[model samples]
Target: MSVDFEAARLASGTPDELAKATEAAIATARGGIERFKKATGDAAELLDIFDEANAALGNLRELAGMIAKAHPDKAVRDAADEAEQELDKVATDISLDREVYEALAAIDVSGLDAATRHWVAKTLREFRRAGVDRDDATRARVRELQEELVGIGQDFDRNIRSDTRTATLPPSALAGLPDDYVRAHPPGEDGLVRVTTEYPDVIPFLTYATDAGAREQLWRLFQLRGHPDNIEVLDRLIERRHELATLLGYPSWAQYVTENKMIGSADAAGDFIDRIAAVAADRLRADLATLLERKRADDPAATAVDPWDNSFLQDRVKAERFAFDSQAMRPYFEYGRVKAGLMDLTERLFGVSFTRRQDAPVWHPDVEAYDVSRGGELIGRIFLDMHPRADKYNHAAMFTMVNGKAGVRIPECALLCNLPQPGDDPALLQHDEVSTFFHEFGHLVHHIFAGHTRWSGMGGISTEWDFVEAPSQLLEEWTLDAPTLATFAVHYKTGEPIPAQMVEKLRAAEEFGKGIFVRQQMFYAAVSLELYRRDPQTFDVAELKRELQARYAPFPEVPGTWFHLSFGHLDGYSAIYYTYMWSLVIAKDLFTVFKREGLLDEETAARYRDAVLAPGGSAPAAELVRKFLGRDYTFDAYQAWLNS
Candidate 1:
């Protein structure tokens, strides 16, 4: 018998179409839940029914959530917002459904395969975590809390997305920016240049702009995103999260959120932060002294380097001390060529090929879709939405469109980012942007390679939440490799490859900021953990942020800025922003094997894909690492990398 597999379709057309699609998906899920409640026969049969119900619900939620964040039309976004709330209600009902829980709990899993068994156990744990076993009144309140959280989180994110603040400055403020950036932002009829808080604008401006006054102006405005509004919204979010955790018997939301993670508990997460901070302290002090010395070159009375000065000063240090000017490489990293290079690089490494899928549906015109194949067989699909626009998601992330199920469905995902858009002038990217592209694409390929699985729940990037970033972080190492850049990093006009000497300088220059970078990350991680660990009602969020910033970071908090209000992770990652650093520890260790072998060696890449990415969430993250490395991961590699 010949079989066909269909890729997941993105919701398109009018706001009404999006609404109908959402309703239809929810209805299908509800029907699946009904069948699940009636399932019989054996453990496998009941599990199949359960997966079927969740697969529909999961796909629905992913679709609606992506639309809410990425869709172009305000009407469609609003419609998606409503659809998310409705879907959350259905999800809460499923989580609290005692009949479905009992059905799964009664299954005889001894005869099932290990993956299915693990899924069953994990599902039961989630059910309990959702308060499914509680009394009717408690479960009802749990449902209310979960439902309210959906809207609250949406409100928090919406405020940040919609609140794109701008600073109006004269053309002279563009003195230190790349020529391409200057051309793109020519003064308007008012003869004033405008810059926004979007990454494409803010990052380059901060790193290259010579006008300290303009940089400070833009920096403060960037920090003020979602202020006043998100202050109350975030407070409400924290308060309600604590209430939900306490209702479920957790001491605090931090403890509740971290219980299932690799770190084990809130205390462990805190200790890990402190350990990393301690490791970064000496480097932080040295880096601070270096920046201050450079600052004093221009201003003799300078005592401390301001936060707005860090990037520009670092760029100067790279040029002066390391003989590398970041702008010199921008012409070689034009956005279009960078995308092509990344795709070409990954294809060669992983033994897969990508062919454009012109007929595929996408929510935006800017999105480009491709079919991922191996050995001439279609395996999965991916979409790239790689530019900024008003009201779009303002960060880089991989959003799942569909989870792969072996012999049943093919995986699909999209990379939503705010990179420079190609227009009349070529979109030149800084080296850091290139690394970010590689990092997020790491998540995409992981989703594709590990996609094929027996169950949706254990498919794609479904590993422990804390370990999810490891694969992506590991891929970033490839960006700094000279051999890898030779394959695609060519000047846009001349078509000449990036010079090996320049790549060496780029690598050397990157090391200068490692200490300060890690400490700053620690500061964010501290804020993420402490906010939930403490009593939200009693502590002032801004004051707590100031204290944490002082302890972990070298720079003092600016007087009027309230960074916690705009810290988007508080809503999504919540108590686990430390995952980035935690995952990096694992990623750095994983890189040791590749560093020893040739970076372009297909044998090593294939081994990693099979041992690490192919397992998905079927086994514990540590087990997956051991399978690849023949030993457990360690922080020794991370410490060496940090201190090197």
Candidate 2:
């Protein structure tokens, strides 16, 4: 049923009155759970109670907002806000019941009888981690802290959205940039390129443009955005993280994050990073030497490689060696074809199908929704938003809107992408974009395949942050395989398959900038680690960045460029930036399994689905991975992949 804003407003009582109603509703919902435990109701009946509680929380939350809006008095609004908080506490408290929590944990997991038991066990652990067994006072504190966290995270993102500064440059500064790139820049009637911190205008100008001066100017504008005031925001976020972790009884935020991940502890996570870093470091240096040699060849006057020069030089080298430009490949990777290929891949691997639905609500005009099914059984739905728009999130991500529950409905997800539009020029996706689409589709398949049998909290993307990237990252490997690319990457104009020579060039050029690319990531992780490892007050972010760059990046670190100030991951990743690399080690090793078994081997794919993705966070990631591979997740495997 659709939520009726007008009806909700009319039904909403005064702050005090609505607070009482909400509390009563929560108690009723909790009572339903008790009755189910007493054997007075079945699993389905208990789920209805859970839904009722969810609805009550949604209603109370909405009512609180309406009351606050309708009231003129600040005191009344504050009271309404308090009422909302109380409702949240009640809902959270209900969900925290140890018996109720354990009962429905993995009830009907994914239409498979075995999955239910796994889900319950996983759910019980989640409750323990969430402090379900804590004393009332501790539980109350947890509720308050959770609300505070929600507010702080939203504030952090809001600050990023609102803080837009501009760098005005002369019209001559735009020379050598594409016509569209120059025109997109807000022109002062006097004729200057007004560059903001937006990606669409900045990225293209930085990468393909022949004008070195213009590229450097736009690069400075993009990086320097995290300056002055942004430093304070970053500091505040870091401080807040430290406080929250300490409050939660973890020694550091890293411990809290790693505890829930595949590595199982901070020490293990560190070891994993160190292992891959060692293997990748020497190879990276070799790669960097090649890039430098190429750079020297281009201009004997080029003394040092800077960040701005990295992408431009890399792209240039790619074209020279590969005879394959990503831009050239983009036209063949039509959004529809890329999407269809992903669906076909899923069907091959997991026996799922996706059909577009006409009557679905989407946030944007370009957004489309699909009904996903298995053997004609309705499993789940997914929404895809693939075109860039003003003020839209620029990165690709899959957001899980619902999670499966036993005796309850399955989950759905939204895959948000900022792809190029099909306009005057035909739309094409670069190989990286194709990989991104596959990566995100992996997440959707993981969530959608869960199919009605687990604690909602433990389903889909709720797994360990480090392990969370495994499904998506593993899928990225398929985008590189020649056979896999043949399924989709067709030329738009000629309808010819990607030529074999072009494929060879692409593979040959893949190692072109290994040193800079790998070390840049290492530098990012080190910088992030330094930011979190030190006290916020003592932190000089710029100095830390300089040290990190000197060690990892061959280029000298530019002063006054506080790039990390705009790093959104700092608010979320904190000390966990290393997790991405750690996960990649797992991904590369896992891809080796697929390669060994034949890339499209159904038996191996089925094993992966059953053991890894479909189980979600039901089993420990390490255990699941070990079970799937029939061996331990050894660092040696990762080192072998990296060195090879």
Candidate 3:
């Protein structure tokens, strides 16, 4: 349940020993490269040695985390940090070795089988990109830039995590709320009720309680966090990113970031967004009209939509249209049952079964570790952390700790979610929550199903950035279907099936207020693109936010609340937020194929597993899509769905 200091230490090894081991690996790799270059050793053997050097460098980075968490001595902590930075430099240098690249590039593709050839080609490209084609001085600069980038990223995330405050409301101020909510949280010694951004505290208050004042208080507190303090951090991070790009001879950070992605260039990404935005704006207007009508009917005084009113109004509109409340559907979709259903769906479709692994170390007590297997052959391991916790990353998502490689250890991943925990009604799960579960599990499948035997570099989550969301988005479509829900949505107490009518009603409501949500997401993505695409000296971030927000969802800007400042996704995603829609285009097309055949057809499922899931990043992403779909994907499918 608690973090295991002893286990962390054992896994990390001693700091000094880790540094020594890293140096030894680099030395061995250098010698191996020389032998291979002289044609005295086999290329496969040299590849193994080179991979070990990378692993050693990875171990050094892990050691830094462990030492920061466990080591009491400041000197040791500093040493570990320095060791990590140095090892990063050394690994980058090895990757830039001309002999290594030449050895890889010179590999006779015809001489090797299919699997080995794939890895060799991928590794050669990676080595070339690492500056193997450049001079030593350029390689050195690249290494320095990488180290600095890592440091800046770390600080950026840390500032957000550490710079938030919890609001306190008096017990008297908690009036007009449900008794259970009020009773669950009593006033502290200071005569004030306390709440953190943790899901358990925040979600219940927002959704169930009748106290408008309390809800508004929590909403404002959550929205305003990491704002003013984080603006400086974001600015610094952007500045550092810009400098790094300039050093790499890129005109802007967006250019540098988009190079490795599926879009190939920032200009292409911009074009893609512009096309979607134009299409989306049309649908958004219709959606806004419906929402505003409902808002006016409810309040009679309501004018334009505000950010805070968006969720509440959308929920009301959905209820009115379908006579189906998502909360009412929860009782048949309890957390435990939904989890079992997910595992069953994966096993049936992908031939992967998950068995609990009790021996593995986990980050949290609520986390459950499982060894995923197919026909008794181990595929990978996953640690599911599916409850709300303080200081944990909020929201339902998956994180890859490791990725699958054939003949080696399969990837390890963590499915982190903020779904409701065991409560009075064990089976209760909001429809949206169920969808969230499936979406995240899709990511897990993608992470583990990589039958990537050869190329260790571009496997699983290592694929092109923009294409990453397709698998997950495709899975969400399954969750909303009646037939799919019937397979798992049974009552927790009696185990009775969820009524077909209820599922029908829920499906009918799927696109209700879809425009408002679409616009909200677009606003987030648009602002992110604008942030990186423009010059910071001339751009006023606040003014930019207003312009972008008005362009999507028009509303008065709330002073003192810096939305981007509190955005954690900006740190990792930056100009890439449009990937959501881009990937959805692919996802919708893939789902259409499933619909054409049969949603759960074994032949189609097998085809998906073999062609898309299994190959991971071993094949080009576009090629994988073409193989699975029998046609090149276009944005037409996504447009059709939106219009429907």
Candidate 4:
């Protein structure tokens, strides 16, 4: 039977309806667990029952979390949050159940296919990690820690989403911003302009606004989000994670989390961070010198660039040195055109088609839905929640609604982003926003294409945690390709294709900020890793953050601003923020084949889809890369790109 996108419980609009649906799902999952405990059947049959139960619970958890993050009504969001907490408690119980673990372990998997064998082995190992074999007291404590971690995580996210600080300034503060941006934010009756900490407001203001004091004010407000409250929340989070890790026989949460990932250990992740930092040190010095030089042109006494000045200076340098003004590209990136052009580009490259489903149920009016198909066979569904709303998630990500299991269910996902909303004026986007759209779409397509795995656990983008970002990062390269940009990058008014010279200049200008950009990423990665590696009770997070910022970044840390309080990844990604760079290294290597052939080459694209993305987590991530490259991936491509 085909999946009914509208029938999904996440579409429920009222809090009561959603709450009842969640309860029903929980009851059904519990019933399935009971069946699993008493079933007498072959290994395959028993495993199917186990996977089916888990898949149902997993899907409900994902949907509830999405609603918690994106739903418009406060009551519904609250209900979703409650549903998620309940679902997590059930999941934790299942993971710690001895009868379920022993039943699965006794199954004879020797005669099964490689994928099934892999699924069984990995499940058993995870069971062990859950402390299923421990004494009753230890197991009970593990469950408590896991459940508490969920609430702590939700609190961290809630504080950031709820606190949107705004800076009110005179009209002159809008001088260096684009005409469209100024039009979008006209002054109030008080004749003062206001900008919020949201991305749609803060990013452009930071990159273009000429008022140094105003920029610093906004930057400080942005950094101070979730402060004071999240400070204590984060401390509790780290302490609980450390306690959980020690209970599981690991020294720290970093070691516990990384043991299953491609990087393999906390020390290995740390070394990788240091290695990348060392390679970029020379470039960091050079980049900072340029920024300081440009700053001196305005303020002769200035010796260092402040955090607020980084973006403005980088944009200035790019325009002056490469003859590329990012503002010029904005007119061509009207939200509607960019959306259509992206779908068209993917259709040509991946041999898939997207048909808009206007009648599909959505949580908000701004969201658009589409059905994906290949050779006329419907494969998946996607929803684009591209614009921001109050109390919504403040970042871009792909959230899964349904995990595709062959012959059982089709994949469903959504892209939740906070780009500019179009109303009276054309909603033009910054070049980097265009890149972000492509990057998130890359994740959507990867999930759809890989969703057909035989086992539920192996379906969708379930690759090693550290390697999951590669395919999406690799797609960002397409945005910079001249031919690719020309396909959709036409001016909204004149309908003129973006000038080739402009594209050339943009690419050249993009290279100028590599060193500083990379080092900034390293600083974030170090903060994530070291925070989890240290003893939560003794170490001062602020001191550790200040030291890492100075060690890895060009700009000095702003005093009295606690950015770590708002670092959301510390909850979700925990110790693996290093995955972004690690995945980029592999992404650069994967792009080589396309560079050698052509960006739009169908044969090459098909091969890449089959080798790298199709297997999902059915195989180790390293093996997938080796299959595509005919050898192991290396940092050569990454280093060369960094230097270029």
Candidate 3 lowest-lDDT run of ten = 1-10
- After aligning candidate 1 to the native by TM-score, how far in Å is the CA of 277 from where it should be? 0.4
lDDT of 2 by residue, 514-586 (tens): 6566666777776666666555666576677787777665467777576776666776677777777777777
Residue 336 local lDDT, model 4: 92
Model number with the top TM-score: 4
Cα deviation of 241 in candidate 3 (Å)? Answer: 1.5
CA error at residue 298 for candidate 3, angstroms: 3.6
Q: Which ten residues in a row have the lowest lDDT in candidate 4?
A: 1-10
Point out where model 4 deviates above 4 Å: 6-9
TM-score-best of 2 and 4: 4
Candidate 4 residue-wise lDDT at 218: 94
Q: lDDT of model 1 at residue 548? A: 96
Taking all chains together, each candidate's TM-score versus the true structure is 0.98, 0.81, 0.87, 0.99
lDDT of each: 0.90, 0.65, 0.69, 0.90
User: What lDDT score is found at residue 319 in candidate 3?
Assistant: 79
Top candidate when judged by lDDT against the true structure: 4
Regions of candidate 1 where Cα sits further than 4 Å from its true position: 1-10
lDDT of 3 at 290: 76
Local accuracy of candidate 1 as per-residue lDDT tens digits, 1-644: 11122323445556787677778878888898898788778667677778877888787688778778888889988998898898889989999999989988888998878877777888899999999999999999999999999999999999999999999999999999988889988999999999989999999999999999999999999989998999889989999999999999998999999999899999999999999999999899999899999999999899999999999999999999999989998998989888998999889889999999788777789999898999998888888999999999999999887888887778888899999998989889999999999999999999998878888889999889999999999999988999899888999999999999999999999899888999999999999999999778889888889889989976889989877888899999999999999999999999999999888889999999999998899888999999999999988999999899
RMSD of 3: 4.4
Model 3 misplaced stretches (Cα beyond 4 Å): 1-40, 55-87, 96-99, 113-138, 170-192, 200-213, 423-427, 553-556
Root-mean-square deviation of candidate 4: 1.1
